[model samples]
Target: MGSLDLEVTVYSRHSSNYHSYKGNIGTVNDNILNQKFNAKEPYTVIHTDIAQVKLSNGQWGYVSAVIDEANQEIIGTVVSS
Candidate 1:
């Protein structure tokens, strides 16, 4: 059978320096797919912002997350303002 195709529906953010991570829609989807394919568990890769900071109206910054692929861990996240 083909890998399970799913999507992350929700996610949560912890305070700065917090050492915990709850998987989101994307992670969940990958998991299903991994099982179906019987491949190594999936993990999250670092994300690079595609949109420019100036894209926001009147906003000087943005919020972004950095996820670790191993163990599905969240490494660091920053919210720009």
Candidate 2:
């Protein structure tokens, strides 16, 4: 292969170091919900989450939302670039 001027493609694998700085930055709270998802009132139980999304311009953005457990509706939302 060397004499014929041909070379094989080599691939490499890498480990993720995204959480390298995870060193007691915040306190872990107790599981108050304990798998209970039902809520009698609108504001009694709420859930929040942040998600990363790919935009149309090939950029990354974050979407944060708060949901009401009783009606399963999104009470608040925010988008950040």
Candidate 3:
């Protein structure tokens, strides 16, 4: 690798200043699930989450999805720019 002048891509560590500026951004909800992820029926234990993604055009977007715990299936999804 060194002989061919090739180098591996490396990711830098997150800056402490970034975290300090972030502070507490969201509200903390109660732990109603109690670490029990399994559900006996559909809709009884559905989980939802949102994720930020970088698009090909150098823009950011968000993807929100809801999953059924019992069936382990994605029931709903929404994408926003």
Model 2, poorest ten-residue lDDT window? 9-18
**On residues 6-78, what C-alpha lDDT tens digit does candidate 3 reach at each position?**
8543343422333335678899899989989999899989989988666667565789999999999999999
* Clash count of each predicted structure: 4, 0, 0
Off by more than 4 A, model 2: 1-24
Off by over 4 Å in 1: 1-61
- The estimated TM-scores of all candidates read 0.28, 0.64, 0.61
What C-alpha lDDT, on a 0 to 100 scale, does residue 38 get in candidate 3? 99
TM-score of 2: 0.64
Top candidate on TM-score is 2
Q: Look at candidate 3 and tell me the lDDT of residue 80.
A: 97
Candidate 3 all-Cα RMSD: 4.4
Deviation from native of the Cα of residue 45 in model 2, angstroms: 0.8
**Mind giving the per-residue lDDT tens digits that candidate 2 earns over 1-81?**
999998543332223344446678888899898989899888989999988665677565899999999999999999999
What is the number of residue pairs that collide in model 1?
A: 4
Please provide, for model 1 over 18-42, each residue's C-alpha lDDT reduced to its tens digit, 9 standing for 90 to 100.
3435555353334434434222444
Alpha-carbon lDDT, every model: 0.44, 0.79, 0.80
Look at candidate 3 and tell me the lDDT of residue 17: 37
